[model samples]
Target: MPIAFTVTYAVFAFILGSVIGSFLNVVILRTPEKMSIVTEPSHCFSCGHRLAWYDMFPIFSYIFLRGRCRYCGEKFSPRYMVVELITAVIYCLSYLVFAVFQPADWWKIAFSAVMFPVLIVLSMIDIDRFEIPYWCSAVMAVLGIAAIFVFPSEIVWYERLIAMGVILVLFAVLVLIGGMGGGDMQLMIGASLLLGYRVFAGLLIGILFGAIYGSIKKLRDSKAEKQLTEQIRDIAEQWYKNQLDRGVGYVADERSDVIVGSISDGAPDIEWEFLDEKVWVGLPDKSELSRMLRQNITDEREGGFKIFISGADVKKVKYSRRMVFGPFLAVGIAVSWFVGAQIVDWYTNLF
Candidate 1:
């Protein structure tokens, strides 16, 4: 291809990506809140002033506006500009890698075009909500299915199936062990089909990044976690006393475990089934206690609390909340799309 044509295509790709990124901003903001992405005009969240066309030109608009609403002058998040820039850059890279460099693998351009946007949306949403949308994973799975027919020579269909199955089982164990979530598992299951054996490389990269972030996050959150533990201990002590006074339940001699379930917007997500009926005189309404606990805990991330007891003494209280893996996994997936084959080959050569 001529240099002129290549540059033109790359420029077009960047423009297209920025436009898509602009739309994705709506998706990331609305999807978690169950708001409609379509039929909703772009408006300032602070003032509800509808944005004009000139105000919504992706990266340029944000730069020109100084990252503030025209109507309210309220500061907008830098994320809007950042997402658009990243998407635009990724789009150009995909075209260069798949279309310009390896023209024979042109189909990969389509794969990356759709896959990267979904990854971006899911990553941002996971960061904000601590959950990955099922639809995002489903879209990847559909892409994986389509890739089987479009690029059969790249990887055998059965290999894709095998990789997906293996990932499903492996991630299931990880989820049970509390090392990962079902959303991460589902995302990888679809990714395995698309990348075949290369999905393992993606997973490895994702885990490596997640582990590093987890370590740093753990250190940073240690103070908050300690404060939360103390709060939980106090709550548990009072609740235990109340239960004992009401003749409802008492911590069994051998089994002294306190479990708090997932807390959400409305109801406390605790699983009452886990509590042993044998040790309880009667189950008490947990709503009041749950409400109180919710007031004390203020983090938006999804998590649970565990309390250990030893003969009427609160031994320890642990709060477990892991950083979102979707973003890290997404980074891995994007990298694998670019260089997974080389990575796989290098690892095999070591043997």
Candidate 2:
């Protein structure tokens, strides 16, 4: 390719990627909030001032205004710039990778460019809101299905079906075991359509990564709890010894009054009455095994020293299928690209 043509293509890709990224921002913000993404013009979240055309130039606008809304002066998230930049990079990289390594297929390059933004949106929304809207995955699935015709030699129909089946079964098992949600299944189906059989491998990788992350967090919390318990014990011991030295009838068996206050406020008695009332109102019993597991896994522990093991009827928050769908899709794309490129190269060499 001529240098001029390459530069022009890069610039075009950047602009296109920025525009798509802007739309993705809207999708990410509105979808989870259950709002119309198209109906509402871009506006400041704090003051709700509608953004003007000049104020909405993707990465540039965010940088020009120092990452704040002009009307309300509310700080815009740096995520906006990051998303736009990432999209642009993906677009350029897609073109470069296709042009350099594979056949100069514009369609393949375009498809790769489009998938990145969609995946980016899904990943961000999943991270922030812990949910993924069905529409996003549906759109990706539709595109993936259509791409089968557009690039028939790249991936096969039966391969896609097998990938979808495998992921669907895996997701169903996770749901049964309370490890994943329905949205994850839908997301997986969509991703499998795009990536075909390779999606299964990507999903395995993502699940492994997620599990490792969750385990690390649990270990950190456990260590913090142990440290806090030690601190509380030391404080209690000191207070008890001081009281004993003063001879104020402070009972050592009950520990110090201050220590009692610390532990009492920190570890309030479980409000079983409130939970029982909720159960009477058609809510699941607080004593359910699932409820207990959710409390153990999800509840935030406060106060370093006092262990608050209160069992209340806490709301259960499940993993969003829609959110996981994005990362899975990204993984599929990467796997597909590598697999497809290698296969294509092998065939070309043999011919």
Candidate 3:
């Protein structure tokens, strides 16, 4: 292709990507809340001012408006502009990789088209809600199934199946060990089918990134966690005391092993099945204490409170808050998508 045409196509790709990125912002914001993406007109979250055309042009608008609502001057998150720029760059790169350099590799282009948006949306949603939507995984699985037909010469169907099975088992173990979330596992299960053995590379990259971030998060939140634990102890003791005063709930003494359970949506989800049923009284109240605990904890998906009992009283409470792993995992998957084959080939050659 001529240099002029190539540059033009790249520019077009970037522009198109920015437009899609604009829509993706809507999806990222509304999907978690179950709001209608199309039906809802773009408006300022701070002031409810309807966004004008000039105020909504992807990357430029945010820059021009100084990252603030025009009417109310309320600041917007820089994330909006970042997403647009990232998407534009990815689209331009995909054009260069599949169209300009690879030339007529429409299948790669199509895969990139579907995969990039899903990764972006799911990554953002996971950051916001600490959960990955099943639909996103389903789309990837469908794409993987289609790829089996399209790239039989590249990756066989059975290879994808084996990859899926292995990822399922590995992630299942991770979930059991409390190292990963079901959402992360589910996202990778679909990815395993799509990427085959290359998914392992993605998992390695994801875990590496997650570990680094988790270490930083741990250091940052250590002091806050200690304080939070103290508060949780106070809350648990008071709540338990109230329950006992009301002639409800059993006495969990030192002999009674550590009571382990998690809080979900500001509710105490105690592991009641293991506890004696005859001594059980009533469901733990989802009181102000529970709400406060939930509010303090960052990652609700893995947030749990450990109750240590002594002398028939709540002694201490330990709370663990984990960082979200979706964004890191998404980054790994994307890098794998682009250079996983090359990475794998290089490694094999080294051996």
* Candidate 1 lDDT tens digits, 1-351: 889998999999999999999989999999988899999888888999999989989999999999999888999999999999999999999998888777546678888889999999999998887789999999999998997998798889999999999998899888987868889988998899899989999999999999999999989888876776787779877876777677675666665555546644423356666665565445655675677776766653455667665545667777755568999999998888899999999999999
Top of the candidates by lDDT: 1
lDDT of 2 at 171: 81
Evaluate model 2: give its TM-score.
0.64
After superposition, the stretches of candidate 1 with alpha carbons farther than 4 Å from their true spots are: 265-269, 278-281, 298-301
lDDT (Cα, tens digit) per residue for candidate 3, span 1-351: 789998998999999999999999999998878899998799998999899989999999999899999999999999999999988999988888878766578898889988898999998988776788998888888888888888887778899899999999998898988758898988998888888888888989999999998998889878877876787787678767776787665454434435566755445556644454443445444354455455555444445667775544787778877567888888888888888888899889997
Regions more than 4 Å wrong, model 2? 219-329, 332-335, 338-351
lDDT, candidate 3, at 111? 93
Instruction: Rank the candidate models, highest TM-score first.
Output: 1, 3, 2
Query: Please, what are the lDDT tens digits per residue for candidate 2 over residues 1-351?
Result: 778987887788778888888877887777777899777777778998888988989899999999989998889889988888888777777876776455688877867766676678777876675555677678778877876788677668887778788878878888776545666677777777777766755676567666676566556666655554554444334433443455533323322111111112123122333332321223322233223333333332322122221122111211111113345445545655546445445556997
Model 2: lowest-lDDT 10 consecutive positions: 256-265
Instruction: State TM-scores per candidate.
Output: 0.94, 0.64, 0.88
Candidate 3: which pairs clash? none
Cα displacement (Å) at residue 288, model 2: 13
Q: Which stretches of model 3 miss by more than 4 angstroms?
A: 241-248, 251-255, 258-302, 310-316
